[model samples]
Target: TKKALIIGSGIAGIAAAIRLAVKGFDVEVFEGNSYPGGKLSEIQLGEYRFDAGPSLFTLPEQVDAVFQLAGKEPKEYFAYDKLDVTCQYFWEDGTSLKAYADLNRFAKEVQSKLGEAELSIHEALRQSAFIYNSLAPLFMNRSLHRFDTWTNPLALKSYLRMGKLGIFSTMNEANQKQFTHPKLIQLFNRYATYNGSNPYETPATLNIIPHLEFNIGAFFPKKGMHDITQSLFKLSEELGVNYHFGQKVERVLVEAGVAKGIRAKGEDHYADLVVNNMDMVNAYKTILKDQRQPKLLLKQAKSSSALIFYWGVKRDFPELDLHNIFFSDNYPLEFEHIFKRGTIYEDPTIYLNITSTHKNDDAPAGCMNWFTMINVPNNQGQDWDQMIAEAKRNIIHKLNRILKTDVESLIEVEEILDPRTIESKTSSAQGALYGNSSNNKFAAFLRHANYSSSIKNLYFCGGSVHPGGGIPLCLLSAKIMTEMVEG
Candidate 1:
């Protein structure tokens, strides 16, 4: 059997291993951490259990597809429930909205609360669906670097509607044009943060993000998000894939532009093919140091990182659900602080996710596990210690004002994940949540390809590579990467 070596046990790496195993290859996974799952792992804070990364779950069919590909019933191994209320939004002005999974219901909610016409919501979603349907085939499901992709009939069809695809405008511009209410526009513009980009700068083609939540629907894993990694890791092992924990891969062994294997723990392990699930920039800088680098792709602006405070709250509020967002008073200025000023905004938009809302066991009987986070600039030698301290004060102040409770007093335990720790823990380049910001329209094309252009048999997958970040896209990155591998 051909041997395959996967560097990193992230969701994408595990998925790639499963793919290779199904193709009858002997696969070995090397992870620096003691456990599998890079960002999609879990953490425990006293009596509270938090999904340490990527709290929101969507595109569940992508997870099911992997199990089905292995000829197993997905539900038997994994399961999740679609969220009826995808997210509850709160503004400082006492305005609140529930983003219902049903389009018509959500439209009604927007109209009733924000005073925007239901038709505006309907029209925005329709445009979102149109963009998603048109672009997914060309930009996502396949490799943008491949000539065959552009020549596909779907690509040709998409070309005919390029002008309508929102590529020319910013996400903010598109939202402003779509809605009259400032709050509604802000709500739609927030979707740009889904991939760690600024709505004010990211191309409006990202408007497709709303379709994933409002149209296809958002979901929550029956367990927590970490189950996504655990289940896939189990499946890979069941398929005879081996895993080496605490084995930090030092370098990719390449001879005459062909990948031989990798070096880890002072020994060389050879394989027929190699897959890199490390951040693309880190892979190029560390593992593939001897190889020619894709300078332009690596030089693109890094995506915004996150400052997460995992708190075990002593109290639970019924108003908040699985996902909730507290809007900042000045959205544009907030992004400006993150992207341009390289600092945290005083009134930053806060995303508070409590898995305990769905899985009662995640917290104590009357408590909750709060995964509170805010967008921040990726590590660039900024004073993180000062920033984290100030951000925490701001977060507590905002929560206290909006929830009408003393947030600082409610925290029974606390754990913080900042840009510095995120980089140290996950090996994401400068701790970027997504590899590169989609601030420019060409960012989709600028992302590193799944397969190395110069090195034969060396492949890349994960949030850092093609298809962009988030769970679904990382899975797609693996699919796209492995498709180029030969059995």
Candidate 2:
């Protein structure tokens, strides 16, 4: 059996370990963090449990497939129920809408609240489904760089429909053109943020995101989101995958232009293959030191980082749902503040994820765990301490205005995660959450490849590579790498 050495124990690393082990390969995962899950981890503050990263859980099938491939019943290891209400939205104009899981209910909500054209909304949704269906087999869930896809009849048919799939126009532009209402456009436009891209600039192809959540479904784990890591780690270990904790790799060992293994903690361990779940920027700069750096790969734009305030509130709000968003006065201006101006605005919108509504243990009895986050500019040498302090005051004031309560006094415990800390903890370059920003339409084709054309046996995964970030794409990265290696 071939031996594989993986750097970083992110979700994709664990998935890769499981897949490789199922293929009868000897697998070892080396992680910088003592625990697995990387950014998708958790922290305890007194009695409160805070999901450290990625508050939302969508597309459980990607995770279940991993357990199934390992010859185990998926439900035995992981289970999640579809959400009836996807999210609750609050605009600055005193209008609110609940994004329902059922299309008819959601359409009714949109039509009643925004006075949107139901026919236009329905047609646009059908088009979104069409685009997602056409691109899924070609762009995602497979190796886009492979020559054989060009030859396959199924792939070729998809290739022909690619032009009509709407990848060239911006998401906001398409949604605005599809509907005549401002709030409705704003509602659909919010999907761009799912990948940490600006709706104003990111291509309309990203409209596929709403289809994934609303049309397909969004899920909530029976336990907290971190339970996802706990269960998967248990499954991977049960499959006999060797895991090295708190071992940060300094160099990717390349002997004669081929990957041998990695150098971590002043010790060199050799293996036949290496998979890096570390952020691409750090991996390229640190691990592949002797190799000629891919300047093009290094230069891709980074996604917006976030500033999060995790609070263990002493009071529960009956009006709030599991997921909520409070819009800023100006959506376009807010994006410009993050991406163009590189600063936080006084009127910054806030996203609140209260998981205690679903799982009571996230907070103490009678209280809620509030995962409050706001998209901010990636690290560019700003005064984050001052900025964060000021932003906290603004957030408290804004939430008070919208939710109609004194926001700050209800906390039993609180902690903040900033861009600087996110970068330090996860090695996500500039603290960007989703590798590179999709501000440009060409971003889809520009994401770093899973396996380099130049570097043999050295591959990239997790949030930094194609077909892009978030849980489903990260899982697909593992599947794509396994297939590429096995083939």
Q: Total clashes, candidate 2?
A: 1
How would you encode candidate 1's per-residue C-alpha lDDT over 1-487 as one tens digit per residue? 9999999999999999999999888999999999999999999877899999898888999999999999999998898999999999999999999999998999999989978899998999999999999999788899988899989899999999999999999999999999999999999999999999999999899999999999999999999899999999888989999999999999999999899999999999999999999998888889988789899999999999999999999997999999999999999999999999999999999999999999999999989899999999999999999999999999999999999999998999999999999999989998999889999998988999999889999899999899989999999999998888888
Candidate lDDT (C-alpha), each = 0.94, 0.87
| Regions of model 1 farther than 4 Å from truth | none
TM-score for predicted model 2 compared with the true structure: 0.98
Task: Tell me which residue pairs clash in candidate 2.
Answer: 303-437
Give RMSD (Å) of candidate 1 vs. truth.
0.7
- Candidate 2 segments whose C-alpha is farther than 4 A from its true place: none
